[model samples]
Target: MFWDLLVLVFYFIIVFYFGFHFAKTNQKEEDFYLAKKEIHWFFLLLSLVATETSSLTFLSIPSLSFKGDYRFLEIALGYLIGRTIVALYLLPSYFSGNTISVYEYVGNRFGKSPQKTLSLVFTVSRLLGDGIRLYVSSLPIAFLLERMGLNLSPEILGMIALTILSIVTIIYSVVGGFRAIVFTDVLQWFIYIFGGIFALGLLVDKLDISIWEGIKNLQTSQKLNLFVFDYLPSGDNSYFILFALIGGAFISIGSHGTDLMLVQRVIATKNLASGQKILIGSGIVVLVQFILFLCIGSLLYLFYSGQTMAPDKVFSQFIVAEVPSPLLGILVAAILASAMSTLSSTINSLSLTWARDWGMDRWFSPRTLSLFFGLTLFISSLVPYFLIQTWEKGILEMGLTIFSYTLGPSIAVFFLAKGKAELPVSGLVFSVFFLTSILSTVAIGLGFQISFTLLIPIGFGIQIFLVQISRLAFKKN
Candidate 1:
């Protein structure tokens, strides 16, 4: 335990030092937010992958496997189909606009009222979503290590881990900006992928299960089904596979192609070609990463010999159960690396959006930005009750649920080009209210899987219908 903690402490120190060291080079808004448009496509690609794979997914994937099999891959299939659509359609829009905040383009197309409204919604939703993700990643380590005779409650341990992460992230984000986040993500990406491979090797060798045998075991257990047609009986609208294909494509196009966190990387590119390349390469890399984690999840079932383990905690459990203590420590560091890479990327982007879109520059100075960034992260780390529920229930459902609820209204404002709609301020304010209410009701009440994937197209329908109706009525007068 002492040795393990020692290695982790050293790792934290190294990350902190590196993060601060890079900050010395950041000086302007472009430097702080977009890495001054100097980031290499390769680094941006890794950062994109890192940002997309949250700690929630890291822990949730194995838990998902334990539930039935590869039903979780349904989500990945959706993501892949979604990314291809995004690369072709959404990528060109971002490349042509060349904006800092993706929301700005929406504003440019429609108006400011809609732009700020949508940006605020995204920031709020992402903070909640990523906050849950951070807690999910940190909690297992806290729990597992505490059982091994460590001294800390799960929450405190969770917070401490988050604090360490925030400090390292702040150091780079405050100083070096986007470049630092992307470059560090390059290093983290290697560690996480290598660590995932190492964990797989440990499971296969330690459990006496060859890769083929592991697959065969899962196949026999009926955990390998990738398609499901069952839904509430008598319900004719039960088309999850279709939703996964169609809804997922639009959701991906909107979130990855239009969301600020992602577009910031693409816009940071030296040129439009490199920007497109980063999206394409990152899409491929993310798909491979998901496959690797999914395989690890399947292998974990064999490692445990069918004994019931906490599904969400199962991935970390395999590390603690199968790997030797020393290597387990390394893997733990790698897991933390996975989580930190994401947390850091988010903090950096959040700061950029807050400063640029919200006009933090008009209200406050740089020192205030640093303090506000830290405060926002601290506040965000506290909202993980959803993590407990998601863990107890299932990962895929929780993620899809979130996407379904938030994506519709966000997409409505964007594709309809309603950013600058005439405002007594009511139009912008009402749009935010409309989207949030619908998303909340759908998420909490309707409870359909992949709701946003289905609803986004519907949102477009709603937008166009409203526009035509309003125009016709005006002409009638």
Candidate 2:
């Protein structure tokens, strides 16, 4: 216990050091958000992966394959194609000018109303999405706390984990800004990947069965199935294929393409070519990473045959049960750090977007900006804590559902590239898009049979359609 606590404390010390270390580099406002140092494509690649994945991934992916098959690989395929499209098409548009955030492009294309509106939308939506992600990502660390025999209820443990993540993230993010976020992202990516691989190796060693026997287990259980493009019956247009590929692509287009948090990273590269490399490259890295985690899940199913466990609980309990103390500290640190990586990214990006795009930097220092957004981030994250039970599909789907909400309209806003719409008109278009998205998500939550994935296209289509119609309706007026 002493060694684990020591290592965890020691690891956080390094994290704080990074925050302070980068604090020196941020002399200017832009430096705080978009560092003056040149970042390599490789750094951005790793950061993209780290920013995109979180503790929920560590907890839920294996659980995904443990209970079901690897149809997620189908979604992974869409993610890959989506990134490629973003790299080739969307990124070029974002890189044409030195915009700090994508909403600048929105402002330039539409007007201040659209720009400020989208930035506010990004902040609000990310408040929900990243807030949920931060909460779920805390689960594994909270599970570790439970194993340590803390005399606490589950709710208290959850808050402890969330506070640990948020504070650590805020410490570095508020001090060092985006540079620290990117560098820590790279470091945390290595840490968590090693933790994951170690878990897989440990599991493989624990299983006494031969390769053939393992194959037999997978075959007998029918867990190896992938690529199910199941369409809903009775002319249900919201099919898995539709959701998995088309919906996946649109979500990716919106997320990687339009969302300022990630797009901030993409355009941070040295050149257009470098930006393209990292954007497309991250998709491959993530696909392989998903296969690794899903394999861990399938392996866990074989290890605990005939045992019933909640999908999200599979990896956490295994770690508490299987991993020894010395390495336990490192893995625990890794899990918490993975969550911190994303949380920190959210904090920095949100603050920078607020400071620059919303013109808050005019009055606030970078540190002040980070602090304001970081505190708001922690507050927003708390909103989902009590709502966790309602998301029955567990953390992974909940996180994705949150992404689908504002992301679709955000993409739809980006697609308004050709003409200048009036501020009121743009606002109305955005309102309609977001309204449709909110209604669709609520209907799904109320047990509507439609796929939640359609929220992306619905938002995208609604905004684009309404804007086009307005353009036509007012063409001669």
Best by TM-score: 2
- Residue 243 of model 2 has an lDDT of 69
- lDDT of candidate 2 vs native? 0.78
**For candidate 2, which ten residues in a row score worst on lDDT?**
418-427
Candidate 1 yields a Cα-based lDDT of: 0.67
In candidate 2, position 77 carries an lDDT of 81
* Best prediction by lDDT: 2
Q: Candidate 1 has what TM-score? A: 0.86
Error of 1 at 102 (Å): 1.1
lDDT of 2 at 420: 43
lDDT of each: 0.67, 0.78
